[model samples]
Target: MADLYRRTVLVTRPEPGLSDTGFALERLGWEPCLAPMLRIYSVPMKQAGAVDRVIVTSGQSLEALRVALPPATPLTAVGARTAERARTLGFTAVDYAEGTANSLVGHLGRAGGRNSVLLATGRKLGVDLAAQLRMNGWRVTRRVVYRTEATESLAPAARSLLEQERVAAVLFYSAATARAFLDAFGEERGLLGSVRALALSPTIGRTLGAAPFREIAIAPRPEQQALLALLGPLPTSDTNTARREIAP
Candidate 1:
């Protein structure tokens, strides 16, 4: 008897980077495919200010701000990964909260004072951290660090894999990615039924709406590493392997 998930696995994260997940799936003996639903690009902030704190929600935002902001400025990150990215860029006085926009805002409200806070974010962001901070009376500025765009085309092979029952799971990192994926699949909801959707957070799951076929799985934390950990099992046998194709 073999494990059930050796079936094909699709990594449908919005970001173009799927090497990490690709390698992980290979290690588990499952075929992996890359079908990124969204692409991220950054636009730098034009002005400078001596602020109380800066909030970074995504790793890309942290990378963008590192090149523009002073190294010594106080910073708070939405998660350890973002904080780690900050540290790599020489931001020493950094604070990290649980990896959620709300959690990050709450921590900033308690820790950040009247100093003008800069929020580096996407062009179309969910859960406005800046708005939340302003409501709490902290001055906030936003730097559009990135843009997420849906891919115009999905790989034919990946599309075929998605249409068939080859995909064992679908991974979503953001709400935007979820919406774009659903759109890409069109009427192929039947394939989704056989797949388990692994969302990075509860918020991502909510954006997916009521799909008749797929069972949604959420990670304890909003991180890729956590998603893998929560799924358990190393996926050894053929039954455990999934035919996976990623669309970016």
Candidate 2:
């Protein structure tokens, strides 16, 4: 733990939520380098029809949907954090998926009675969840409540720190951020080679691929607590061979 002191960890999430990650890192005595890899901006979309259930892939898309949809509308989220946020927003029927939108789609199919759903999502999506549900005969009202453009550059401070080879670890919350980070820093393979990547899920790790980091450790869960758990000393290999998440 002596080596963990003040070690810089690059946090790549959009603003507002970026602050949350910063605070969490600060609590752990880790220096957080803020270099948002995606710009989350709200888009004015219409109020969804009799929204039987609301599907939220990203927490940033919640605000727009809350305003557009009714208060008591049931909500389903891709992660625990999003589900918790939805519950706090006066939503009673809040459920969460352990994984991505694809996981949520399967969860919904078995949950039953979620006939009509307003999928409050960002413009950019890794999986076409709406289309998947539509093919299965579910009424999916796909609402792009937020526009996410992949960030192509980092802040000068973050860039300088990376160039200096000072970034010890990187925290990736989403697949989009993984792509964006590589987009901006793929050329600096030398800088990236020594850094450890802590990804929120398997998909995020796979998206990052094996080229960038010395080692990639994936959290057991997709929640913040799970991601933060990897802040300590990492093992040489994972014991869970059946679910080999870590990539070398």
lDDT of 1 by residue, 122-182 (tens): 8867346777877888777777877778876667877786666656677777787788878
For model 1, what is the alpha-carbon lDDT of residue 141?
77
Candidate number achieving the greatest lDDT relative to the actual structure: 2
Best by TM-score: 1
- CA lDDT of every candidate: 0.72, 0.75
Give the range of the ten consecutive residues with the poorest summed lDDT in model 1: 238-247
Residue-level error in angstroms, candidate 2, position 190: 2.0
The residue pairs that clash in candidate 2, if any, are: none
- How well is each residue in 1-248 modelled by candidate 2, as lDDT tens digits? 42333267788887646878877876666667777888878988776668678888888888787677667777888878788777777777888887577778788774346588778777756248888887776788887888888877766777776667666788998888888888886566566876789999898899878456878999997778888888784332222111101110
Positional deviation of residue 27's Cα in model 1 after best superposition, in angstroms: 4.3
Cα RMSD for candidate 1?
A: 3.1
